[model samples]
Target: MTEPKIAIALYSYEPQEEGELLLLEGDILTVLEEDASGWWSGESNGKTGLFPGSYVEYVDEQLIESLGLEQFEEISEESNNTTEQDLTQQQGGEFSGQNINDENYVSDEENEKDNTSQNQNQQEIIQTQNFTRNIGGTTMIHDGFIWEEKEPVFKVTIGKTVKRKKLRGMKKYTAYLIHSGNFCVTRRYKHFLWLRQRLVERYENVPVPPMPEKQFQGRFGEDFISRRREGLNRFLNRICEHPILRSSQIFHHFLEADEYQDWKMGKRAAEKQNKKEVPFFKSITCAQEVTKDCDDEITEFKKNITSLDKCLKNVENVATDLYLSNYQDLSASYLKFSKAFLKLGSEAKGIVGKNLDIEGKELKERGKEQRKIFIDPLKDYNRLIQVFIETIKVRDQANFQYVSTHAKYTKQNMGELSGQNRDKLLLKQDKSDRMTNITLAEIELFHYNRLRDSKEILTNHLKTQIEYYRKSSERWKKVKEEVEKIPVIHGSKKLEGMEDLSEPELFDEKIETDTEENQTSNQIDKEIEKNDEDNEEEDDEDTDDEDTDEDDDDDQTEETEEIEKEKDENEKNEKEKDEKENNDDFEKI
Candidate 1:
């Protein structure tokens, strides 16, 4: 039997069965067998499953070879040019390519040779253009330093919960980046922590911004997750602003690498490169200075932790004393009241009394449960705060040792007379510096990790608080429903005189009805008045229009009369002229 070949996944596959593997896009998988159907059996991320064969493709050897050839040619050409230039300089004569008076010295044969060389160069240029077109104008360059200016765009989306081996189901956040190409990486809060740690380790001088606080209580809450997504966006934007860090190989791999193993390897390589063994003496002074600078921040952090501890304790005390204690007291009182009601000897009253007794007992039990819910989470929170404080104390102690050793080393270096004494002081300083560096690193790691844990503890406590209230509300709802179910028992009391109560109730109802009737009548009258006003306004407008129409009709009649008079005058004038012309013609004849 031959070993199965490996193939790269072109698209992500979410398996439907437990045995099936979850394959991310760009993941390398071992192909075991092929089925008659399009599905092929493959193993990825240590899980074997059937995947669609079309979703993956084998790595192409030709493409890899072409990429290598392009890089080799570029390097070879540069080296050849440098060698030619060097040889020309070593000969101590004018370079052959230097310009000269061609008319005075050059022959026809030399001119022909130059023209042929020029034609050859043009042909090479034309060939290069054709080659570029053949390759879709996108060249694959192998030089690691070759970088293009591309603005990275980040988008985050909350994905489905995924169950992993030996761990609780985790919610996935898929981060998509648009840079040279569209790249997507799915991660959780822990992955964010890992990235932050690496950034801090690699870029010591750069102030790495904090991530969204881990929330255990609302770890899956929509609003919290949204805020976290926004925070992640800001974090990436900050990372992009740094010149050196933005161009980092690891950073690029983190954004663009499709294969998880390849990305991890790149990160590991970056970390190794960043790791440096410091001279003990030099690092001791630096550590002391760092401790001094961080004093205020550390103190502030401690104060916050203390304040949080106190707040948690106060909440626990309130829940225990005010709520639980009150519930217990109320339960006892209700129990005594139930006994009194049972002694009344009415069946309905007895049932109500029994229900009240049950309610009291239930309330008491709920109080205990609520107390546990509040106190248990608080205890864990307090413990976490205590741990944080202790860690800070240890950090302070380490700083004290660094400062003390640094002072001693400085004193010895300043006053030492003998060579041996000076050497010993130097050795001590080196040891001190090494210890200081280690301690400082530890302190920083502790500080960040402690804050992260504190946030988780607080989140858990808040979740517990929410659960307590929810359960309490449910219990109260049940109590209310049960109380409503109990039948009321009638008794001979002064307040229960139906005839007297009926008169007042009937009077009140009659008054209410009368008031409503009056209101309706008033509203109707107002509407009628408004309508009358509107009608009057319309009538006035109509009257105005009638008057204007009459005036217009009178004006038209006058104009017609004037026009008829003018026509009559013109006709009379024409008849007179005709008569006169007839008389003149008769005289001429």
Candidate 2:
């Protein structure tokens, strides 16, 4: 029979059913039985029940003895500071069902070798069955990697942009659909900004991937949304992959909480927690022993990591430019080229045209899948590299904190560094060690991931290129075969849809129109001739009458003229005798 093992509770677990043990954080229990399932039979405070092995971490009895009364007293002080009821109200129900809250309430950074059995069981239960299963994790180096499974533990996909209104439509904004597993939540960009701010406040020394920069102009554009959503996805994936951050109560609420009210409550609690100025290092679990020589080792690792970061950044930048300029731009260009050819083929109408249309359609289809296979992977990897660089920076900050704390503590005189002050210094030392362990593990894990991810990305890149060329060749071959099937024709044939071009009918219509015009003109000419003859006859009659009247007047005038001539001759004889006498008398006067 195996001897009973003593374990330390890393979290507060409330029993959801009978036969379950209620575990308070930092409580010690005597473990009686172990199971391949995550449950273990344990006795604590004279009460015996079954508890999840993950809730309480098993400690070596000798190590516990070495920790002695100081550790217990510290635990007791924590208990006194926060009452049982307050702990329940504040943090009990947000355990994510069976999920552990290592950042806020548990120790998740324990050595994996110590909890291999429990770790296996835990991984079996909690998984993200997201469709992006191609993130290969099998056949990887087992050096402090957080995720054991081939895929990410949780997949956070942001899509389905919904324009929403708040406060009776007075305020409007876009909400992105964040779906992970069965639980989905809608969050705005502002909400993500708020989340980023709060996480940084809560975990100053821990790396929190920054969201994409905010922009007011064209914020709702499809391109901007796609870019921002992709960035947000990378942020969530980083947080999810983190050993410490993944266990955060804030992270859990952000991801799995589906209701608005629940989200608000969780948000308020996290913000409130942030205001307390609690040491972030206190919650960190330092499973590995931090030796004095670790600084040199850490320095060496830092040099390598920084060098790697610089090199990787350069590569990522080039890859991004390549994706934008080569893959994305070229894919669209190919599709456009295909569409123009297809249109030409459709317009031309022959066996060759049909082949062109088929080829164009097939080529156009390459754009969508090409983006999926090549562009997406490049983008994902580039974002991951950025996250890595950010983490390295934060890890340096943590190391700086530890160094500062150590320096100050050592500078104190021995007279003053006694009792409670000494105890406080010891706590600081432990916290520093924890900070180092966490940052180192995280850095190591990142390096491990870098190798695998680079392999996958390169593999995908090569595969996409090979497939593209192969498909193009195949399409040309298909067109060649199609061309070979074209039959030779002796004479020209009527084009498709041109059979209704009737030339003889057009000529007949023109002839009929000309004939109708000729008949109408002849009738008009005949009417004009008859009217002219009638007018000429009327004029002749009027002229003859006018001549008859003139002759009558002339005869009358002739008779009157003869009478006047006779009278004038008689008067002239008398006037001639008188005028001779008068002329002689007038000459004398």
Candidate 3:
């Protein structure tokens, strides 16, 4: 009698017995006999032995027939004139027999063709299964390329604040995903964080982009919420750009999940599947050693993070303690000064003093505001630095463990270990290699996130500080103008004691001015002598250009003559005016 065939659908953890068929997951076996004890004898890979019937699942012949029929139908549909039999014949004789439920089958020649077609189809299916699995409606094509009719896009908008019972009435930042407008999903920053973490864990080779850091202060602030929403949109766009990462299940779920709980459940199931141990032989690439050079580079990165952390901490300390304390002290001194001005009462007080008091109070408030602004941002930056340092430390530990495990396995496999022992070693090596790659990717991600987050925080902090100081300066400038307008008060002088000067005092002032003019004339003569010496030096330097020098000297002599004539005319006019003024004064006397 012809025996039925079965395939192992899932892995069996049971130990193999002597004279028993050891069925690996996905192994095809031809069933021979079934016993009442739920044991079935089967032939697999040319060996005949008994195995548990529960350990294997029967292959669906009807399903294969249906698939073959669908192929034939597609061919027939493409060609209007093609008959069903003709399409079937063209499909390598896959549907040569009667219907699957029929009592009579095809002839031996057709059966032979059908067997050949089935074998070919099975081979093709096995070869393509690993690389071409349809994940989240995304078709993975050859060479790990994901093919889609329309590339998915995220049109993210910050929606109204959501209040959930689980969130304890605290408003949550809600992001609405109008995914190409075909479907929509509502997610929070936390959901996105969860998706990102899963993607990083599952896809070791793919480079996942960084997400925006969580803002504690402005958790529900409008601008912060809008920024985070846009950031998430950009992040999704980046994921779509990568072929492998785009087809990832978590990414798909993030875009398509209608309910948060459903997405969570799906994520959990996917994570569980991801944890399944893949066969060592299936992952041959893992046997390859991660080079020592990578370890050295990671070590260097760790050192850089350590240095950066120290520098950031110092900056944070300065912002909080040193600079903040200085501002506070200045504010207190201003307050004291304002109090002293108030104590002077009406004697020293004016509108200017009141304005100064107001300014001092404003300055104190500003100092406190600045302290909060500077210290709060620095605290955020310090936290990011700490996270970066910790990530690197964890990565280093993982790397060390992986390298040690890999080296030990490599030694054991290379030595006098048996076949099974070598297999075990190789498996251990593969696991270690995977761990190393995971940790390495994490380190890279941490580094990227650190740079992204720190840059943003520092930039915003500086902008805020600049804006604060600019406004403060404008306010202080108005106060300074008010202070400048205050008139100076003289202690002893009275307005009634002042009087106009007499003629003798006015004449003495004129005589003093004449003596000062004579002294100025003596100084001008000395300056002219210095100039003449400088001209002589210039003449010595320009001895070869005697014609040009002669022309310059002639010009200088003409200008000097003109200046002397003008000076004589001015002296004559001044003497005439002085004589007229003296005659008028004599007539008045």
Q: Where's the lowest-lDDT run of ten residues in candidate 2?
A: 129-138
Q: Which digits, one per residue and each the tens of the lDDT, describe model 3 over residues 1-589? A: 4366544322222234678765544455678887665567888668788876655555556554766644533322222111112222221111223122122223468765755565555545434333322233222222111122235533443445453444665644455544534667777677778887877566543446667677778566655665555556656765665544665666777777788788778877767655442321122122223455445666787787678768877887776665545554554455444434433334333333445445545554555454444555555445545644554554455445534554565465554433333333333333444444444544555565566656876676688678866876786687677667756777846543122333334212112224433343333334334433433533444564886889999999999999999999999999999999999999999
| Model 2, span 432-477: residue lDDT tens | 4555655666667767667776787678778877887787678678
**Native-to-model Cα distance after best TM-score fit, residue 148 in candidate 1, in Å:** 31
Candidate 3: what lDDT? 0.51
In candidate 3, the residue pairs with backbone N, CA or C atoms under 3 Å apart (3 or more residues apart, or in different chains) clash, namely none
> Candidate 2 regions off by >4 Å?
1-152, 166-172, 326-428, 459-463, 487-589
Candidate 1 residue spans exceeding 4 A from truth: 1-292, 337-354, 415-589
Ranking by TM-score: 2, 3, 1
- Candidate achieving higher lDDT, 2 or 3: 2
The alpha-carbon lDDT assigned to residue 284 of candidate 3 equals 19
lDDT of 1 by residue, 140-184 (tens): 211221222234433433334332333343434434232333666
| Model 3 spans > 4 angstroms off | 1-127, 130-289, 322-418, 441-453, 486-589
What lDDT does each candidate get? 0.49, 0.56, 0.51
Task: Give the better candidate number (1 or 2) by TM-score.
Answer: 2
- Tell me model 2's lDDT, rounded to 2 decimals: 0.56
